[model samples]
Target: MFTSDYKYKDYIQEIYKTFSPLSWLLKIFSLDSLSRGNKQKFASSYWALAKGALTFTILAAINLFTIYYKFTWFYVELIISVKYADAVQMIYDLCQYFVDLYFVYKYGSDVFYEYIRQYAYIDGMFGMEYYGSIRRRLINVMIFMISMWFSSSLSDYVIWAIGFGLMSTTFFSMAYIYMFIKILTNLHVTVHIMHIESRLRVLGDLIQECYCSSVSCTARIEDAVIKKNWFYTIKTKTSKSQLYPLKKISYVNSNEVKWLSRCYLLLTEQVNFINRMFGMRPVTAPCWTKGLSQGEGLPIITTLGRRDGYRTRYEKMQAAYKDLLSLVQSQPINFHMAHFMRLDYPLLVSICSVFVTYTIILIQSI
Candidate 1:
């Protein structure tokens, strides 16, 4: 199943096989790039592309037909009856349908394939340790998928019990699919960010270890002079280290420092690449809980933002080491919403505030 074109074919195949079930599900919805046939590669499969397009066409047609039917049968009655709330809800549902269709189509193209390639490249560079436990990830994905389906089914039953028509329940089911895709996409992006953060953490630990190795502690006697009316008393004190043998002096070589610096630069590049690739999705999806969790979980980037004190601690190191520390300190990684706003606490607070304000207004008007 491995293709000859990709260098990391084995790794790509392993990853593809590990997540094949998820891939199959997404493929059915036209939201993934993995081929249905046994072929695996780091590039987009024409078979997947054709199948996804056909699937999307069919789904899009169904969505359009359902929207038309709902507008004609349900929303028209609501609007004629002056049920503003129901009419507004219908409009929102229509908008959501379009958004879901757009999301599926956009991600099903070569863009997702490129993302897979970049991910595989990063995995090859960092090795499997940084990727963490694949079996655990698969288990989590399965549990999440099952929970989503269960919740969707429960909601469908509730919708039915509420006297809604079959079409109405079907629309809600579609909405749930969109919600599932959005949350799963966010989860995958968060995992990627975690992987990058792990490597950055290792780099930070290496810097600390280098500093520790290069440190040479010397014991010195400190003389304190106290003068009292025509008398002088001198007190000499020695550090506790003077009582024991001096530890051997070791230094972090320039080559190691240079290597660390290069690694830091490469990692930063990957961060930027990820931001560029996945930035728009955050802007579109805008999930609060996931955004908040990511902001809190990613501490290394935040630490880099306030790295002045961190840099000061390593000021006495060699020029190369200092440069590496500066490189680490200068670049602060934040998941941005297509360069509009950062996905952090402030963004979450702002979103909640706006929602509350509008909700209050909506209730008052109603």
Candidate 2:
């Protein structure tokens, strides 16, 4: 029952044309297409073997240099042969392998979410896509725990000492990383929630506009009337409750009803998508707070201890919800407002900072 004011479909087409190749690359990995020759070959030749050989060779050289610097000029005599060193050297190589795999999984999913954000930008220059990729990367990294543990084991201590001052720097900074990840993930979830909500509001406005328009109303009134009668009939028959009678006193006709029904179905589908996006499907463990009221082990972000900074953000989100309510009540929903509402700007800034800090750490480590 909704009508577009402008040619949104054309814009969507343009976005797809511009961004399809990137999406296609992500889809290749996202779908787990291990059997595909290109994927398998890429993994074996470029990722698996090449990376493995290079890392092992580097580690062996490092071991040789360590021995030579410490003791005699005959580094090979002090240690086993470089060939034998390859075996123990593989330990470091294995670490690097998993770290690289973790990076692929991390940044790969990040790039995919980034594509989604870019598409959203076509709808409007909404910033939901801004930190969306960060959240996806963080969550993927968290879930990909095996790779993280392996990274720690493979850490080149000597390299880190020379590069980053000392291993103790990373050790001391670990909690910051964890906190940043948690905050980023939570903010991401909230942003996604806002995006879906905004879309629904826009669709709702479109439906209202289409129905309230002169041409569509005139064309569909007869259909709306017939369907309204059928609706009452079915509903009355299905329920024995006398709370309200199935009144045949409805104004809508069949065509209008049909149009509205289609609109309602679309809206309902969007709702379902929102639920799924929030991870409410097959209900898993909650991300942040659990209880209705904040308490121990709650993800519901409350102000206490060193968390006072989040209070302002929490209030801002609450204010955004208020704006959402006002938009839903207005005609021709303001998607610009709705779009902005989905992002917690403060949280986004924080997450962005985390990326900056982590990148600095990674660079320093290297």
Candidate 3:
């Protein structure tokens, strides 16, 4: 899932798929067109995004300014004197939109190189199909998010189209940022975790084969030959001080072991990086330890990650693939809604919830 043989455009395509419309907007920001453009001839890739965000932020500020200037605006009689809550909430959301956009601008290149260029560049459909299954895990969640947004939007501005229209552009700005965070997170999961899953499965098989194959019997045969040679040496020397031979053990699958060891180390490194990227434990593959150890027990895996207090790497990976993605459960989209939020579900829910919560007041006031 995270191969590096392909070019950067593949990532653009994948990122593009998350939401093509937003990708198009980001492109105007030079996400693709000016990727190779120098600042001499072009501005920063985030220029368009920054300009767009600023425009919306300005609009929201004006609305907020108008609301604040009214003085009585804070206490809209929307129930028991909510006081500045709605105004404050909208201001907070707009600020959040700024923060989200800033993260995108700063990390834009690093993310492209790390995910799209390095990990998300899969070569074939066989791997993609498996990865796609894991990716779709969030589809239900996405559907729920979209539906909630629509319903809340429908209910919030039933009679106040003018007010809603003023607020709509501001909210759209935040939604764009939300969508960007989502696409980035999904790419993270699809490339890192799913790729880990696929690699670990392959590793488990390799480990199982290395351990289960006949390494022990070959040693026995070598021992028998050594004994025979020892007898012949004694006869040939036939006297005096005896010479002794030291037995040196070797892996029958030494080449295979070396290859597997390299593969395992690389795979674990990848897992560690991904886990750390989102502030999870450095050794997260072990989250699947119990599941992988079920039914089949370990069979002579010395190079496993067990000594460092993690389960066998392969097993952990197996479990990781089967387990529910726990990167950001409280979030509708992983890591996107993490921490503070002014815009996104928090803001959307705030606007709608507050609107509905005081809908009765609106009816009375109107």
Candidate 4:
């Protein structure tokens, strides 16, 4: 009697379907919006996508034709060796593997080119913004998701291995590209900072030159000058040098110092935020953690200046930009790769594993 009781499960499913009118309508609308929203951008993105698909299709057809032509003798030989069916099957599997690899390589290249087109111009000229960097990866991410969804096969092991391989390659490449972008952006940002310093020095000199006849000050204010960094040397016609200590800001008094501290703190936060976005801990967080954790008397990983040392260290450089972002806020949006291109050890290691596995599979197939 219990074995024949299908009514219970059917009743439960029916009950689940019996939501109130308002809830049903709400669910329908939500689903509709989601479905529509997802494809909204595809209308425009599709044209280029179609051209890419067509090109790939032509290439694949040509490749297939050529391979068949060249391997015609092998196919005849395999047909003659009817007892070696397993070996023939392996050869077929090997050909399929190469075909899959070709598609992956083609798709990855297209997506990467699209990224370059969208970001290379502006990011090349100006430094990338925190969020801007990660947003750049959205296309590649979408491609990865789509590939994973469509690439599933009847063989779970092969599917898993291949899927993992493609994903690993995608993320590893993304992380590498992001690191390259970060280094380049940082270098450019540093150059821009140097330019700002030079302009400030020039302005200070012009001020002294224009106001020399109006003021009766004789002793140079070199001693009064605030130092920001060691490499940041500000010199004048009077042979007086304004020394800036490492990571210090040139400010007038205690108030400026406080302001600079806050500004630097914010910049530190931004850098850390970007690092976190890219899966790295901010260098400043340890310091913030160190002070707080010490006060609280806790022995957590949050402690700053740990003997083990933190992974990322951009607080000193980014601190200068904290106060400067007010200007950035008013400017048009900028893109950066600092936030998007992060991959953890798990991700990195897994990717390598996937590649090795994929290589082995390919070799076996061949």
**Winner by lDDT:** 1
**How many residue pairs clash (N, CA or C atoms closer than 3 angstroms) in each of the candidate models, in the order given?**
0, 15, 2, 10
Q: What lDDT tens digits, residue by residue, belong to model 1 across residues 28-87?
A: 555555554556543345655566557656656655776666666667645343445444
lDDT of 2 by residue, 183-252 (tens): 3334434444443443333333322222223222345444332232232111112111111124432232
State each model's CA lDDT, in order.
0.51, 0.34, 0.39, 0.31
Runs of candidate 2 exceeding 4 Å displacement: 1-169, 207-257, 280-366
TM-score of candidate 1 relative to the true fold: 0.62
Model 4 agreement with the true structure over 73-122: per-residue lDDT tens digits: 33464443342443444344334333333332333233423422222222
Q: Provide the lowest-lDDT 10-residue window in model 2.
A: 296-305
Per-model TM-score versus the true fold: 0.62, 0.27, 0.43, 0.23
| Model 4 bad stretches (over 4 Å) | 1-50, 75-347, 354-366
Candidate 1 residue-wise lDDT at 290 = 32
Judge candidate 2 at residue 331 and give its lDDT. Answer: 24
Per-residue lDDT of 241 in model 3: 10
Measured on C-alpha atoms, candidate 2 has an lDDT of 0.34
On lDDT, who's better, 2 or 4?
2
Candidate 1 regions off by >4 Å?
1-21, 36-39, 43-52, 75-128, 134-138, 145-149, 152-156, 162-168, 208-252, 282-317, 343-366
Clashing pairs in model 1?
Answer: none
TM-score pick, better of 1 and 2: 1
